[model samples]
Target: MKMISIGQLAKRTGASVRALRHYEQSGLLDAIRQDNGYRLFDESAVQFVERIRVLLRNGFTLDEIRPVASMLAPQPPDLRTVCADVIALYHDKLDELDQRIAALMEIRASAGARLAFLEEQRRRGGP
Candidate 1:
């Protein structure tokens, strides 16, 4: 495998250097530190970065994508036919989203009731 510098990876993926650094920090990508004090990566990192971009575009957070990040290797598979791990991750994300939605619904209901009470008070000329 050809080892490429971080600049090459950033250029190939059109991801900013800062974002690549963030990926490394987030444990979503890996690199090797050269003696010259530069980070290097295998050429396959292009695929990984692309996959990360696509997932982010589709609302997959870095944490959510971490489990399957390395599975893509040099190429990403068709997501419609995902592996068991990916399927489980999807289900987990869905469940998390459902819980968030339920919580938001409750908050919305409370806010709406408060708004209605304030409107009634205003209508009655209450200070």
Candidate 2:
């Protein structure tokens, strides 16, 4: 079990050093400090960071990821309840996305109508 420095972890995880530090600060990761004051991470950090990245890409905010991260920790308790809660969160996110898509669609239709109306006026020489 070779412990690696933060830089190596960042390279392996494709996450910036600053982001790694931020994750540590956010309690999403843990690092061991050497006597020389260098931060070392376990190899398992690679997968943990990947999970974090996936969650972020999937629209989960850092704050929202905290609990999910906890659920993935070693020796997690019964996950049935957690799964239910996560399902609810996902549903809420889906609802919000639906609303946003509808609003954008409405805006697109209005803009298209305005453009068509302007084109008709131009064709009619009505300014």
Candidate 3:
């Protein structure tokens, strides 16, 4: 089995050492320490880190990402159950995003209306 030191893992994965440490602290990634107390990561951890990056980029909070992140580990989940859970999570996130978008659109409309009113007042020579 090929093993990489934490620094090499960080360099290859474009992740900061601190970030990796955080992941380790969060139980998202595991590192074995050498006799010298330096951390070593398995090669497979690189792929796991990449998966974490994907989950986080897709707007998953750390808490939300943690469960999904655990899935990337070697432990196996029942495929159908896992798929259903993921679908549910996606639906929930979609609803939240929809609500946020609606609120933003409402704010934009209000801003536009205010702008129009100001423009009209300016044209009428109102201070």
Top lDDT model: 1
For all predicted structures, in order, the TM-scores are: 0.78, 0.80, 0.82
Model 2, 66: alpha-carbon shift in Å? 1.5
What TM-score does prediction 1 earn?
0.78
Count steric clashes of candidate 3: 0
Q: Candidate 1's error at 76, in angstroms? A: 8.8
Q: Among these predicted structures, which one has the highest TM-score?
A: 3
Alpha-carbon local distance difference test for all models: 0.86, 0.83, 0.82
* Backbone clash pairs in model 2 (N, Cα, C under 3 Å; residues 3+ apart or in different chains), count: 0
lDDT, model 3, position 68: 65
Model 1 CA lDDT for position 123: 100
lDDT of 2 at 16: 96
Q: Could you give candidate 3's per-residue lDDT for residues 19-101 as a string of tens digits? A: 99998999888999889999988888998898777767777676777766656654434552355656666788889889999
lDDT of 2 by residue, 1-127 (tens): 7788999999987899999999999999999988998999887788788878877887888888787686554332454345665677678778988999999999999999999999999999998
- Candidate 1 achieves a global lDDT of 0.86
Model 2 residue runs over 4 Å out of place are 74-82
